[model samples]
Target chain A: MAEDALRILVIDDNRIRASVIEQGLLEAGYSHVTVITDIEALMRCVVEIDPDMIFIDLGNPNRDSLEAAFAVSKAARRPIAMFVDRSDAAAMSAAIDAGVSAYIVDGLRKERVKPILDLAIARFNAFFRLQRELEETRSALAERKIIEKAKGILMQSKGISEQEAYDLLRKQAMRQNRKLAEIAEGLVLAAGLLE
Target chain B: MTGLRHQTQIALGFVPLLDASPLIVAQAKGFALKEGLDLRLLREMSWAALRDRISIGHIDAAHMPAPLPIATTLGLGSLPVELETPIGLATGGNAITVSEELWRHMRDAGAPEVAGDPIACGQALKRVLEACQKQPARPLVFGVVHPFSSHNYELRHWLSAGSIEPDRDVQITILPPPFMVDALEAGRIDGYCVGEPWNSLARKHGSGRIVTTKNRLWPGIIEKVLAMRSGAVDADVTRRLITAITRAAEWCDDVNHREELADLLSQQDYMALPPPCLMPGLTGELMLGDAPPSLEPDFLRFGGSATVPLPSQALWLYAQMLRWQQTSFSPQDAERAAAVYRPNLWCEATGLALPQPFSITTFDDVHFDPGQIQTWLAQYAACVE
Candidate 1:
């Protein structure tokens, strides 16, 4: 996930707060951090900028403003580090639920910025890897089910047992040098079309 | 004099909306002081954020959307931290507002003379949707604060009653309440359903017209509550906090306190809105764009036993959740959902009798029975997409 030039998006309404975050990133040798205070067309700006990471600093957030920032994390898969002056437990839980990597409360030190950014990236990658693995496993299970159904169809179409049908499909996949799932899918589709 | 038995400084979260007044009222007007509590009100911009903050001990409690606690308990969207409401803050402040252009389209299509009529607005909206079909690419977009909010359910209910399917006939998006006005002004969304002073602010900013209030759509249900993480605070602190907020609600409900309430909420620290914008929802003298100011004296009930979260409200919210496929219902889930409303604690804290479910009218003929959530969901499914 290393970009040639890291593009960071700093979302903060306060000029000083934005500067603190921006200066910290800049000091850490990140040259492509964009500070945005205008919330009117936040999504439009995000689409235009397409930052690598997002850091949100809100002076004192209200329900609507927080949603604007939260919507960003929801709409994009980017790692987010959210800083609030003070927050409630529920809001912290919500930030986590919204897929925010770090829900920092009352901490805005410049030296701490790089570590937080690194930590957020690490957590986001770890969690997203687990999710991707879960999805892969589910699809693999689904593929196995389809292959089994195709094998059954083949067994019925041919005067053979299930083991013979499985061997026939394996032989065809090996001979053709194609993925077993691809061949199985074609068979399943053919059977579906036939009946 | 009552004194603190345990803690002194308590941090609470609130949105910058009209109904959030109870928390501000409790903090600013000496209710918290009288109850031996030192309160710090943290203004939050998103309900989810406030819910998260309250759940993780970032803050002790919050002024949250009514169904939030139930959704959280059922693990609807956010992390299922055991959050519950000790007392309700206010009810009936949410309204559906549309862009000025959209309002004109709705009015030309035969909207009602009575701005509060849900059926009339629904019919008008249907006509507008039909007209927009000619330009199918630019479907009229409507915004709701959250997917799990009453605003979403009520807007869907209104649109469904009008035979307008959400995400089909029109695109319903989520924008936090604060952004609704700007989004409408920017032409990102044509309409939105949000709590006060947003509708009032929409009007103030000349971004949208207040078409109808949720009070007209669903009158029985209370809209917001004072939410706290389950076991976040000590039992004594919880009782004292409830007592303080309940007294603040009474102060808010008083006619004599309306002006003071408006002024207090209108302050820069609270809603940061004009007194006029805050007053319409507080005093119910709503100024719908171009239409004459209608007197809806009870537009919002800040005071009274309404703060007591009735079990029926939870059942209704749970059934809506099922209708929208947000959560599945088990027979025992109703008890779990409804228990999010701490009426037992409310009674224990305030010595007040449990309040019964208030009467309400829906856009459809569906009636709700808290005990029969499954049956209700089955009947209500026909009305939802």
Candidate 2:
């Protein structure tokens, strides 16, 4: 993996603490990392950097700040790895809910950041893929339902069997070189228009 | 570290402060180990984070701000997680401090040199704020650890008694306790209401002066509690944890154990601040910035029925929650919130010395009767405007 190719953002108020994680990233050959100390400009930073992933090392973070950070990660849809000094159940769960890949508690040694980053990216990619697949499946189901509805309308309007209506739609799909969903969508649209 | 057999490993959370001494003392002094329990103390920084972590079950339990359990249980905050308090951990650990500049202004406005009744200091602040209203360099900002903290309510009460409007005359910002001293030093904030060591630390570092404390504001107002996920901790585990904590609290309260408690808390893994900062709160003779070591013998208490979870205390928290508009006043919900503090469990765990849950009386002749919480709050709201 070309770890050096990745651009990352490290969020922490303390310059020294941010360096602990920043130092690790640099040693791991990732030079394109930005350390942002001011949280007020966090979302703006995320928008400007367009980084592949984000690392937030918070010694002690408040709910309001974490919520703000969560909003940023959720909007960017970037893989996020977070380091917190202390965690209660709500924070870890909110991290997972926010699609945070690596929600590590306490143990963020300098030698450990690379692997944690990798793990975060992996988890994020996996979760993202799952979300994408789920969306695709849902759309597919909706498309199938519409096609079925268009077929039923044809069968009723043309006095044809269900299979014949489906075959007609399929032939139209082939003849027009459009997708079955597109053809079926056109038919539904036309039916609605005519009615 | 030996002969006792245990059943569960409990991960408890605590914010690093003078009050966390009992829990730290427990672990370091072998009280937890003696109970055959594996106790891991996750030191957190903010009350909000700790509440969230405990709510989500990342931590099994925590040394919680007294009101947090009820707030969490009611699902009032961002995340709704049911929480309960099995025991009160410590009381009288908070102090209010103002930056050196603000303290000087208050003194100039005729506030007493040290520990003037908080109301008198608040009146001094009111006068200074009026004088600053012409130029208005900045609205005098004060920081609290959390909205649901006793620090918040007590500070509000102290300020309001002098007719200092909390939000209008002053700004109350929420910061993690650790940064408060730094913010004061940097002149970003003028004052803060926070627990010991931080107040003492601020004063010690010449950033702020101690104005008043939990001892003076509302004596015996329960400050911190041991909160757990409702039903997450089984009966036997709760019993053993309480036993360990009780022993630890007693050891923490002892005059002999003060140095050892300070020593244990000063380690890098714990508070990590200097031991001398911890001494003032422990010994109860606090130095208010350049002020002399004033004897406030009950500055912070660590042991005894102080740890006993009181239903009445929970009601008091509920009343504050209602006043803040966090939750609407309701008879049924008030009972449900108060139920989070388990007095019966306190009896069952210790098997003796169960003090009745009582009301809190403040220095300004204001008495909190949990039984008449709604009426009191209504009267309080009248007093404010």
Candidate 3:
């Protein structure tokens, strides 16, 4: 938990993600952080560096790394910032949600693990939130485009005003207990049939 | 035609291993259609994903490792889920492959030439490894498909036979079979034990040489089994699926249908390997790097007694689970897991005569009885524990 010279090993396949993690750790005032890309070199690095904490990006979730952690955890049983009691379902769920798969060697200080796990969970949550927002925006844009296309088709086929076409879709949505986006999607799909 | 009845469509998941033959056969040979089932085979990347998908109800059933259902039921790797069994699809199709560099090392170290003989090759490699260990930092890196895999247990068995301590003398790593050849070629691993057509592909690509076949090491071993969620057994659709799979397995075991079987497996729907590349392995042939491939028909066994789920194989797998420190399931747990092997259900589905007397104490060529299996497992533990 010391601010000065806390050793951290950051593993990520993506160079940008690794740099971001390394920068984040550095910015958080941790020193002596190492970023590694090759999963095969993990065991050797674990032996040589003996980092206080290991941070693995969840994007890849390589089986080799997980197996290595299991073997190393069993072999050394060292106290590091990764082990949590299997009985602690809450901690386990939080750890899994954080995109960090970890094993702590026995005898490691609990405080050492908490900070790294806290940081990891925060980063994972941030990434997930950003992803959700991006998806929502993309879906909304797609829905708007579809509704515009449906309005154009209605104007050409049935000679209805844009306002009338919008009212029809809204009426259908209310009648079917579906969202306006769903109604618009159906309209766009139906419009494609004329071609 | 008889009065039309409602047909249930299902999506079954499987990894692209040779042992998944029954599922492939059922779908490919129209057995599923005959049974009023519309079964689609979904190829998955990893066993972990397969288990997760099945547990989440994304897949109706799966052709999984025999130990998987029991392991999941016991919550060894993940959450507990009730698993049911109607039939075991195929048995005993795994082998160990050593990199060309490791093969050369063994050759230079007075290892006897076996040509295509796996046992002899294994013995020779053991001698070379023993001599090589006198030098410091000479750790041999080996790979297995999964920690809970039969390939891992078989590899340990082969290594123990040569008096090699798997953990102390060698580094045993878990690598997916699809990546085994690439890892070997890149010298990331010195050797691997995996299921076919991986071994065959390794040999063909000249990445590695076959050290031993599981059939040679332990004949008639159970490889993959057909498994369903525990609640699935109550469904009429699941019953139909079991019958369809049993019929396909019988057809697959027919020697005359070997070509057709190869064609089915080679299709994009299953293993997706070329017919010629996969045919020899499916037919039980040894595709060696140095010499001509040898025929060993019992290599990829299916149906008959081999397909009958044996309690003894379950016991063997349980012993392996204990040995690997994956679980500490007691004798009661072993018995309960073994009971999940439904031989009678297989009989009902296939309409084949059940093996008379149902020996539970005999160590047949293909399966060891529960008692013999316990003894064998205990002996292995004594040697390696």
Candidate 4:
């Protein structure tokens, strides 16, 4: 099959990550990339698409079903094999570590799948990085709210200004060698206990 | 304590099921610590992920399905990553459960009302399928945990012995254990053969009925093993690890430890179900629908001879692989499969005599001589045909 004509399927439960991968494949000029977010309908979708290559996130539990399909699917013209490039162990390890694995119809030339796999690895890593950043941002925002509450508590109890309360909390955190959030959390807990 | 026995950190991967209790107990109950090993138990979502993680050296060892090492070593499924089993973690935590509707059909076709009889149940299922054949409906779909699992082979063996052609008369698919009950409830599958807690969960939900168990299908059959990448650890570490797990297995097998083991297995990082969900498999007190609970003492064993890595059973699994056409038979391949189960390693670790080779006995009367696998295959094939 021609490189662009190779029908690609991506199975990832995370819609945003799936879309990112789908967009990457589309932008790379692969015309036949299909992204599936619903793993429940995977069996039907796989049969209907008969894609030459499939991409699944390592975190997806439905990867077992895909392996089962590889074991028993009679509809495919060519049996699917878990994509493993023996000559390039580093690439294989990188793909797995990036939380993506590719399966292709048996006998597909490696040169044809390499760019798609590399793109998937890059996209998966980017998605994970984004997810991590989102988590950190969420925690940071929560910490800011707690700090604000702790500052209000200190100002009300100790007859201090908000800036002074913040400084006190920072100084206490430095004295204890802990994060500012930890100091804020301690104050919040102590305030709650006193109440 | 610098040179006086440092702890070795081992990351062991496992799917959350009743059979993974040994590893969990070893970590939770201080068996691993006593042996100078830090066992880190990692819960994997599926067998494929566990296999991949262990294959790529992401995990140091794993609680694996018995047939996995043989299948992977023989290059039947994916890339061959040679795994070795120094000890068997568990045997017989699996059952073939069918939806209540399917169970009714089987009963109508003269299956016993209670579970435990494999052959009669299989025959009744065959009759029910024959009845369904005249209709223009889809084939009855069954689910198993993995392609190379003992569940698949036992399910297939049960069906074929009852004169049902597995691939033709019925369709077999794969589902993770956690999905088995949902699939049955949703009518996406008619039945499933999977390890415990899932089967008992289905029974508890009244969505599925236990038809036959692993002990009944293939008595004393090895199901799961403590597997590691070949040469992953040194001899001292391997021996220490084996001692720890063996002790843990003995603890798991004690009747008094059942409740504690169930609680440990129900932790969020483990099976995560209610302790009661794990009880039936652990205690072998199965409930088939609203009927009285059936007592099967050997439903899931982990102690005594159960912990040994039996090469004969490995060959039996290889024979099943050949019987089902997962891989063709060759003398070298058979040797390779048998070599996956390292009883010698177990012996060296335990300072025990090498156990004599024991022939496997199944529900059927057919002889399972590992030395005469070809002859046994010919006879088994003739019987099934």
Provide DockQ values for all models, in the order shown.
Answer: 0.13, 0.13, 0.08, 0.53
TM-score of 2: 0.72
RMSD of each: 26.6, 23.2, 8.3, 2.5
- Which one is best on DockQ? 4
Better of 3 and 4 by lDDT: 4
Per model, how much of the real contact set is kept? Answer: 0.31, 0.29, 0.04, 0.55
Model 3, range B304-340, lDDT digits (tens) per residue?
7667776666776776787667777576778777766
**Interface RMSD, one decimal, each candidate:** 6.1, 6.3, 6.4, 2.1
State the lDDT of candidate 3 residue by residue for A32-126, as single tens digits.
88988887787777777776666765334354335435544545534232322322445545655555544444455666666666776666666
Tell me the TM-score that candidate 4 gets on chain A alone. Answer: 0.93
Note the Cα lDDT for every prediction shown.
0.73, 0.76, 0.71, 0.86
Model 2 DockQ class = incorrect
TM-score of chain B of 4: 0.97
Instruction: Write down the worst ten-residue block by lDDT for model 1 chain B.
Output: B357-366
Residue-level lDDT of model 4, residues B1-385, one tens digit each, is 5632687899999888888888899899998998889888887787777777777787888988999988877777787878899899998989889999999999999988776688888889989988997885989999998899998999999999899999788999888889889999999999999988888888888898998888888888899998888987787888888898899999999999999998888888887788988888899989763367878868998977888998998999999999898988899999999999988768987889988876687898777999888887897677654
Top lDDT prediction, candidate number: 4
Worst-scoring 10-residue span by lDDT in model 1 chain A: A101-110
lDDT at B311 for candidate 2? 90
Total clashing residue pairs per candidate?
31, 7, 5, 0
TM-scores for every predicted model: 0.73, 0.72, 0.69, 0.92
- How would the candidate models be sorted by TM-score, starting from the highest? 4, 1, 2, 3
